[model samples]
Target: MINVFFDKVEFFANNKELIKLIISNKRDKKSDLKKVIIKLIELKTELKLSFAYNHNTKDITKNFGINEGIILIQNLLKTDFFNADLFSTNETVQLISNKNNKVKIKTTEPTFKAIPKLNHDRIKKQRIFTQNNIYLQELGIISQNGKIKKDKHDKFRQINKYLETIESLLQESYWFTSGKPVTNLRIVDMGSGKGYLTFALYDFLTNSLNLDVEIIGVEFRQELVDKCNVIAKKSGFKNLKFEQGTIEKSEFKRIDILIALHACDTATDDAIYKGITHNSELIIVAPCCQKQIRKQLNLTNEMAAILKFGILKERQAELLTDGIRALILEAYGYKTKVFEFISTEHTPKNVMVTGTKISQKKNNSEILEKINSIKSFYGIEYHYLEKLLNNLSV
Candidate 1:
C-alpha cells in the first residue's frame, strides 16, 4: 500500500501535474509538529516541491527537487505520519492507516483544478508593494518606467522591510489568523517625515490585503504634511491623510497600530507613552539621538573606566536607553523586542523597539526592580519612558 502511494506520487510528478501533498496525524503524539504540506512550484522552468512544516508555534518551509520530494514524502509516511492527502491536477488520493497497521487507499476525481504558479523568485515577485505602484513612483522611490531609483534603493528596501514586519505581526494576531473581520482599523504614524513609509503601509493594507484601514501621518512640518496630503489624494488613497503636529503635543485617538520612526531624544518616549495611553495594540518606534541618557550618566562603577571614552559612553547610553524602554513596556503588559531595523550602511540610527500588547499579566514589580537595578549600576537617575509612564493615571 505504501509503495502504491509512492507510485501514484511519482506518476503525477513525471507529468508535472502534482499540485499539493499534505501529511498529518503524527504517529508520535509527543511531537511538537502538527503537520506538513508540500506544493509543486515552478522555478526557472524547473519543477520543485515547496515543503512547509507546520508546527504548533511556527511554520518552516523548504524547497526540494521533484525526485527528492518524493523520497522525503515516502520516508515521512513510513515513519512519522499515519494519514496523507495528495492532490493533483486531475485526481485526489487519500491514504489512511489505523493503529493496527491496516491501510486504506481512496482515490477520486479532483473537485477543482489545482494549478501551480511559476514562482521563479519569491522575494521579488511576492513583494507587498511592487515597483510600478503609483505611490512608489510618486514618492520618488521608483521611476516612471517602474525601475527603482539608484539613490532610493535603500529607502525602498527599508519600506518593504517595515511592511514585512507589520504583516508578520498582523498574521500572528488572533483576528488575522482566525479570519475574523477587523473593521475600522486605525493606524497612526508619529513623526512621519515626508510620509514615505506611511504611504507604503496604507497601500499595502488597503490595496494589497484589502483591509478597511484609516491611516494618519503626523508630521511637525506643515509643508510636508500638505505635500503628503496632496500625494495621498493624487494616488487615490482616500483613507490616508497627514496632519501637522509634534509627537509630544499631538492628540491621538485610539490607535490599533502606532508607528514612530527616528523620533529624536525623548520624543520616542513620548510616542510610546501615547501609544500605551491610547490602548494601541502594537507600538513600533525607531529611536534617534540618545542624548538624554548620555547627559544623565554619572557612572562611578567599574564600568566607568570603559565609559570614560566619549564614543563608548554614547553607545552604552543608546543600549541602556532602549533596554530600559523595553523593560518599561514589559511592565505595561506588552511583549517587547529590540533589534536593528536596517543596516548601518543605509542610516546610522538602525535600532527599532517594538511592543505588542499581551493579555497575560506580567510581574510588574519584578520588572521594575530590574529596571531600578540597571539604573543604579549605570548611575542613571531615570529613563524618560519611565518618567512618562509614571505620570499616567492608573
Candidate 2:
C-alpha cells in the first residue's frame, strides 16, 4: 500500500487535505494511482479509516484504476451537505476504465445468498413468540437512569436491564427460545467481567421463564469463567455457562443474538464480527475505550486541531467507531440503529449499536451510500467489523 502526502495548499479543509494528497501528491496520476488506491483500501481495512465519510464518487479518477474522474458542482466548503442530512447527495464521478471489469451498481436490497430464509410456517405453527417479555423480579432493580440498581449482594442489576431491553426489542416481532425452527438462540457476552449480569440473564431466561437457551459468557481469564460456571450450575442454570476465550478465536456457533458490553478498543470490533460471522440475527454492542482513534486524532493536522478540540477528538473517535460499525452492519443487509446503552455505576462509555437482519431482500444502495459517506468523513477504512465482513470466518 502507498502512503498519502499532505499539501501546504490553502484551498481545502484538513479532511479534504487528505483527499488532495491522494489526487495531487503523485507526479504521474495514472501509474501512482493504483498504489494509492491499494493504500486507501489497506487503510480502510487495517486502520478502519473513512468512518465519518458521508459521500462517495463514481468518478473514474477517484476509482484508482487509471479510470475517469467524477465532477461535482456542489459547494465544497459547506459541512451540511456531507453531514448525513443529505443522504441523497448528487455527487457524480464517471468511471474511466473501459476494458476492465465493469463494476456493476449494487442492488440495495440484498437477496438471501448463503443463509436460507427461515421457514416462517414453523413459527406460525407454534405461537412461541406470543408470550410476554420475561420479567425477572428476583434478578435486581433499575434506577431512574438506565443504570442497574444493585442489592447488598452487589448483583449487577444492569444485566436485568439489558435483558429487559433485549426482550422488548424481540417482543416487537415474532420470537422463541426453545423450538426446532428457533433452535439457534445463542448469546455470547464478551468481557463477562464479574458475571453478575451473566447469572441474572441465565436466571431470567431459564428459571423465571421456562425457555431453552444456550448462553455462553466469554472471558479471557480462566479463573473467572470457572467461578462463573460454578455459580451458574449452583444456581441451577444448565444452559448458561461461562467459558475462557479471546475475542479473536472464540467458539461462537449459530449465534442468533450477541450482547457485548465494554470490550475495550478493537475487542468490541472482534465481538461484533464474531456475532456477524456466526450468522447472528441481532447484535447489541457497547464499546469501551476510544484510545485507538484518540491516537489518530493526535496525528490530525493543524486544521483539525484548531476546529475540533482535545475532548472533541475523543468524541469523534467514539462516534466514528460506533458509526462505522453501524455502516458495516447496514452493508451486510441489517437494519442498524445507534444510541446510548445505559448510564450505570460503570464508566461513561455508553454508545450502543443494535442491528437486526432484514427479513427480505431490501435496497442496499442507500446503506452503501451511507457507509461510503461516513468513511469519507472520518478518513478511515476497514473497521473491525468490515475486516471480518471482507474475509471468511475461519
Candidate 3:
C-alpha cells in the first residue's frame, strides 16, 4: 500500500479530511507512488474540490513527468486555473487560503515534487482590485492595516467582479465614437445602496483609468446618502457625489453611463427609460423583485404544466421581463448583452443587463415585433418598460 500525505491537511476545514486521508497514506510508499499527481480546479461558488489517486493522475504523471497543477483556487469565478509545472526548479507557486492564513511549504523532488500542498488556501495572481486601495479600506472591505477583513471577503470579490464588468465595457468599442477620445463622461447610478459601487467607480475612473468624469448616486434613503457623501468628501473624490431621490424624479441633462443595480421591479424600467431618453452611451442594470411581470404572466395551457409551479412561474416571469427589456433596448438601436455578473452563491440575483448605444443605427422593427409576440404568447397585457417608451413617444 502506498502511504500518501498532504501538506496543511489539518488546517483546511473544507474537504480537508478527505484530501488528507488520500495523500497522507501514500507519503512513505515511494516505490508504489507510480508518479501520481493531484490537481484541484475551481468549479463553482460553493463547491471546493480535490482530485487524487485516480487513473487520470497516474496517466498524466507517467506521460508528463510533472503530476499536479492548481490554478485559481479561491474565488474561482473571477480567476483562471493553470497547469503548474510543480516539478520544474524554476517554478514559482503562490498560495492564498483565508486572508489571515498563509504559509510556505518545503517539499522533496520528483515523486511528490509536482504535488501541490493540499490546503483550502487558493492561489491568486495579480488582483484587479487591491486591499491597499483607500476606497476599499474606507468601505470596510479591508482593515486599517490593509488586510482584507475576514467577513468582507465576499463583498471584496463582488466589488472586483463589478469592476471587471465596467472594465470590459470600457474596452468595448461601442462606447467610443467619432474617432475621438472620451474625455468628458457623466454617469448616473440609480438606487445606489450604501454607494459601494458608486465610490469604487469614481476611484477607478479618476485614479486608475484616469478619465475626467462626474458620477452621481441616487438613493432614496437620506441616511445612506449623507454617509456616502461624507466619505466622498473625505476621500477627495471631487467628481463623485450621492443624492437623495427616486429614479423617476431625478433630473439629468446628459448621461454617458447609466447604472441601476438591484433596482426592484418597475424601477429598473424607469432607469432604462432615463438612459434611453438621455441617449446614454452605456446602460447597465441588475434588476430585482420582478413582481410586475409575475403578476401579469398567464402561460398557455400546454406550457402551464412546468410553469404551474409557483416557484417555476416566478422564475419564468423574471427571465421574461429582463428578456423583453433587452429586446426593447435592441429596438432602440442599442446592442445589448445579458449575463451573470457574479455567482449565485454570493447573491441569488446576479444577472446583469448591459446595453451600449451604437452608430449606423436603425430601428429594429423585428425585435419590437418579437417583443409583442412574446408578450401575447405569455398572456402579458402590459410591460412597464414598453409602456413607458410608448407613453414617451406618444
Candidate 4:
C-alpha cells in the first residue's frame, strides 16, 4: 500500500501537475515536529519542490529537486507521518493509515489551483493593495517612489486586511451570489475620519472587482469632507463622494453595505441603528470608547467584586456593550459576528462587530430574552442600540 502511494506521488510529480502535498498526523506524539507541506515551484528553467517543515511553534522551509523531495517525503511517511493529502490542478488524493499499519487511499476533485510562486518573498507580493496603488500614495501610505512608508506599514496591512475581509464577505453574500443581478451597489461609511479605508474600498470594488459602485463617506468635519471629495475627483473615482454629517443625522435612501470604524461611545450604536433601519445587507463597525455601559453599570452581584477594579470594569463594560449589540442584531434577523478588527499593537480599541441580514423575519422574543438576561446579570439598565431600535418601533 505504501509503495502504491509512492507510485501515485511519482506519477503526479513526473507529470509536473503536482500542486501541493501535506503530510500530517504524527506517529510520534512526543516529537515537536508537527507536519510537512511540500509544493511544486517553477524556477527560471526547472521545476523544484519547496518543503515547509511546520513545527509545534515555528516553521522552516527548504528547496529540493524532485527526486530528493520524493525521497525526503518517503522517509518521513515511513517514520514520522501517518497521513498525507496531495493536491493537483485536476484532483486531490488522500492517504490514511490504520492501527494495523494498513494504508487506504481516496481521490476527490481539486480544492485549490496551483500557485507556482511558493517562496516567502513572492507570497508578500500577493497583497490586495500593492505599494504602487494610487490611493496608497494619495493617503500618504506610500511614497512617490512607489515605496511604502516605514511608519505606514501597519496602516497598509490594516487596509489590505480590511479589503480582504470585505471581498470574502461579498463572495459569501446572498445578494452578491444568487440574488437578482445588481447594476449598481451603494455603500455608506459613517464617521469616515480621513476617508482612508473608504477610498480603499471604493478602489477595490470599482477598479479591482470591476463593479459599479457609489460610496458616500460621512464625516462631521466639513474640512475632511471637502478634502476627501477633492481626492476622489483627482483619483477619477466618479461615483465616490463625501458628506459632512454625524452618524445620527446622516440619511441615505439605500445602503447595500454600511461601515463605521472606530466610531466613539454610542456613535457605533447609531451606525448600527442606521444600518438596521435601512435594511442594509451588510453592516461592519469597529467600536471605540465604550463609556456608556461603564457609566450605567449597577453591579451588585458576585461580579461586583471584579468590578471594583477600574480597568477590569471598563473592559467588562466594553464586552457587555458589544455582546448586547450582537444579540440585538440577531433579534433583528441578522447573522452577527464580533472579533478583533486589527492587532492590539496597531490600536487598543480594535474590536469589530458585523451583521449580515439573513432573514426578514426576526427572532425578537427569544433573542431579547437572552439580551435581558445578560443585562440583568450585569445589573445594567439597557444597551444603547436596543434603545434606538425600540424607539424606532414607537
The alpha-carbon deviation from the true structure for residue 146 of candidate 2, after best TM-score superposition, in angstroms, is: 22
TM-score of predicted model 3?
0.67
Ranking by lDDT: 1, 4, 3, 2
Provide TM-scores for the models: 0.74, 0.56, 0.67, 0.74
Which regions of candidate 3 deviate over 4 angstroms?
Answer: 1-134, 174-179, 360-362
Task: Give the winner by TM-score.
Answer: 4
Error of 2 at 13 (Å): 64
> Which stretches in model 2 have alpha-carbon errors above 4 Å?
1-157, 176-184, 297-308, 344-347, 360-365, 392-394
- lDDT digits (tens) for residues 329-373 of candidate 3: 888878899999999988898999999888436466788789888
lDDT per residue as tens, model 4, 1-394:
6777777777777777687899999999899999999887766656678889999899998888888888999888889989999987667889998556788999898765432233323433343455556667877888888888999989887887787777767756775555345567899999998988999888877766667889999999999899899889888889999999899999889988999999899999999999999999999999989999999898889989989999999999999999888888888888898988778898787788899999988659988888888889888897888888886651
Residue 349 displacement (Å), model 3: 1.5
In order, candidate lDDTs are 0.84, 0.51, 0.68, 0.83
Q: For model 4, where is the 10-residue window of minimal lDDT?
A: 115-124
**Compared with the true structure, what per-residue lDDT tens digits does model 1 show for residues 1-394?**
7789889888887677777789999999988888999877777777788889999899998999988999998888778889999888779999998778788999999843634334523633345555557777877888888888899989887888877777767766655644467788999999998888899888878776678999999889999999899999988999999999898888965888889999888989989998888878889999999889999899888998999999999999999999998888888888888888788888888898998888546458998999999999988998988888787543
Q: Which of the two candidates, 2 or 3, achieves a greater lDDT against the reference? A: 3
